[model samples]
Target chain A: MLTNRSEVVVKKEMSLLERIYIPAILAGMRITLSHFFKRKATVNYPEVKRPFSPVYRGQHVLKRDEAGAERCTACGLCAVACPAEAITMVASERKKGEENLYREEKYASIYEINMLRCIFCGLCEDACPKEAIFLTDRIVPSTFKRGEFIYGKDKLVEKVDKRVDISKRQTQTVLEFKQNKKFAHNRLYTDKQLKEKH
Target chain B: MLAFLIYKLILVVAVFAVSLVVAMYSTYAERKIAAFLQDRLGPNRAGPFGILQPLADGVKMFMKEEIIPGTSNKWLFILGPSLAMFTACMTGVVIPWGGTLTIGDQQYPMQITDINIGILYLLGVVSIGVYGIMIGGWASNNKYSLLGAIRASSQMISYELAMGLAIIALVMHTGTLSLRDIAAMQTGWHWNIVYQPLGFLIFIVCAFAETNRAPFDLPECETELVGGYHTEYSSMKLGFYLFAEYINMFISSAVISTLYFGGYNMPFVGRFVHDPNVLAVLGSVFLFAKLFFFIFFFMWVRWTLPRFRYDQLMNLGWKILIPLALFNIALTGVLMYLGGRLH
Candidate 1:
């Protein structure tokens, strides 16, 4: 406590209006009346979704290649990088005539993300050697079962022709980050940059 | 005689149902208004715009486990909320909701009763309000409950003196105790408020105190009194107390509107409307508008002001409000005497 803090003396005298209290009450009522018409701060969740930032980390998505094949080569960088130890996958050799199913020689036979354990930090997205994993703006749906929370490949992976919605992720922060810009600008350098950075 | 009896029954039921519904919605509106004041939306889930929220709340209250504390007066505890609610709902009879509605050859008024001693009846009912709090607190067998009850009874008694004085000033000016007659006299917006502004002010302050609203909500002040008079109460018994408060507020608003704001009489509205039934309906609407506004004002003050300390509350009620009421009465008497001589 500061010793220099002066103890202010009380002023007991109140003006006629202060004694009446009606005028002061009217003034306060005016303030509250103004707020009644002002825009409400409620989001009305479920029906109306509030826009999240582009960098907003959420549900995990396993992506596909341009040729409609699994992009993950099971390099284990994402699993190793995951702080929560939420991701697990079993790798298998892509057999003959399986080029349509998998891009690389090696492919993930089983991939599961324990959503309860998963923090959605986007670390796995950054650690993916094959650019197969991403944390989309998709909110993790609440579930009653712990088993249901451990999302399998069917839940995590994008469909063959379907595209991930990244509209919210294209916010001002992404525009300022040159790397986010180069994701659309250059694929060759992005791979090289990731490899060199890793 | 049969027709009159039937009409009275209908009017009484209509008034009772309307007051209960208004009280129910007041709970919802209070929350919404409070939310808006704090820049938030309150209860928009149960139904469209949360209109069914009160129904849901009623259901919840009814479903809750009813508790009666051991070593307490069980009958008095049961009777507490019932008395509070009974006294609350009982005040609606004398209020002039609207002028007479003439159906065919018959003329029936919108009020349940046009009791000549209407104002006196209101004051009597208001006095009886103290019993509910006292009984509930006493029966609870708790110190905090007892304190709350004492606060409630004392506050009611102190404020009632000023309130009665204020009403007397108005009675002198209007020269009638019949609420309907007083309202009819203040036709075309020639309101009693213009004549007795000071009296109106005192009355409004007393209204707040009598309703046990904020600044004087010492009885149910959650922080200090725990649950106050209703501390040991649960389920519908607790609901009844809360419900009674809102009903009291509605009745007070009606009384204030009738006494000061020309009741159901609207500004220049009488000139344009001549049909008796239509006019009566419109008057009822205008009365409701005034009631709603005054109710909103009650909630507005609740959120804006802090609770008063016991000593400060006592000082204001006894020292200031009492003298102000007396002075207002003297001023009104002088004005009425002068006006009569000039005429």
Candidate 2:
């Protein structure tokens, strides 16, 4: 059984200075004053760019072969890979005498990808056997129209020859076909000749 | 007479320009101070650490479309912020910024207007500032706005009593109503705050309530009122309301400095600066420094404390402030009488 206790424990009284308003106000002022001297966290935009991740998705670019020919071989793999169902490709057969221009027998004559529909997934690159398409490090420029985003072959293709030259000593494996200068003559064939042979 | 009128006109324009500019910069200062407290950089992109931010803000305000509510009284809606801004600007007139600066034969007082009943004039002007809030709230035709107006009016009235009582104690001690004369009385070590510390506390709290600053900012409570009184106002009209708030802040700071902190009088400043003209300028600078300190204090408190609830604010003003002010007054009277200080 517990008995009730009447005695109360006395707490320390507030000081006269503490009870007065000035000290409390001064304390609050001190906190604000300290903050006023601290460094500002604002990053000056435009002049200072924020760090972007390595896998950041930006503009799309179509890859090219060493001979500067477009790598896309009329393959509709990109259209299937897009999650957004944004990619649309129109493939056509390579014209007569266009074998040197096109890598594959069947080339995309009117290859136009609707960029508006493209989800910018690297899955398209994974799906392509030829490794034709890729997203560049550069971000896509902002535009107003949906129609302007439909990228044609002219807009997607690499404008410059971006191949890096290797030293002759660094070439570990020399192909047997390049041993004879006569093999180079046979390699330069017209689209008709190559198609007929195939 | 024409030249004198032209000069007075110039002075009025000068004071208005200076006060408006100061208020605008004070907003920037408040933001910078808040950012500094929170360990973040404030605006610094507009022009050289965002010095032209006020200009940009002014341009933005001007460019914005003014919206008037269909059900609201348009005339009173316009009148509200105008009145607020007007009352705020008008209070600066009585503040004695510096003593007389004599150049050759002419001596000019560094004050806009010095009436005999200067302290009472300030009190009356400050009291009228409530009307702007009340009118804005009423005209907004919003339940929240009306509630805010009602709260603001009641709170202002309650605090005014304590504030008035505190002023009375100061007046009793000083035996003068003119601010210039009151300032003159506290020449060296005899500042009003030294004699009336209790009165100063009451007055400062009442000043906070009167200005609708935290923890007494129940009128424009964002959580409850959704912008409170001027909810319906937009464009430059809304800008006017914001501008008026900063101006009111500046005026309140000036009033506090003038009343308790010896206006512009600096201790032993006279000994170093022999020239009256230099002393006058220095005095004005001292007054500005004191005002700036109070302004920073206001911003500091705003960031630190949450606002008081309506009933809590009322209780603070009526139950605590008023009674305490009365007691302080009684105490001052007894002390002065016993000490034979009062003539």
Could you tally the backbone clashes for each prediction? 1, 8
Best by DockQ: 1
Q: List the residue pairs that clash in candidate 2.
A: A35-B36, A40-B40, A40-B41, A41-B40, A41-B41, A42-B41, A86-A117, A99-A191
Q: Write the per-residue lDDT of candidate 2 for residues B24-138, one digit (tens) a residue.
A: 9988888777777787777777799888888898999999998888899989988998999889899989888778878777767878888889989998998899999999989
Q: Write the per-residue lDDT of candidate 1 for residues B117-194, one digit (tens) a residue.
A: 999999999899889988999999999999999999999999999999999988988888999999999888589888
Error of 1 at B305 (Å): 2.7
Number of residue pairs clashing in candidate 1, backbone atoms closer than 3 angstroms, sequence gap of 3 or more or interchain: 1
Residue-by-residue lDDT tens digits, candidate 1, A151-195: 888988888768786546545664455346435455656656888
TM-score, one value per model: 0.85, 0.82
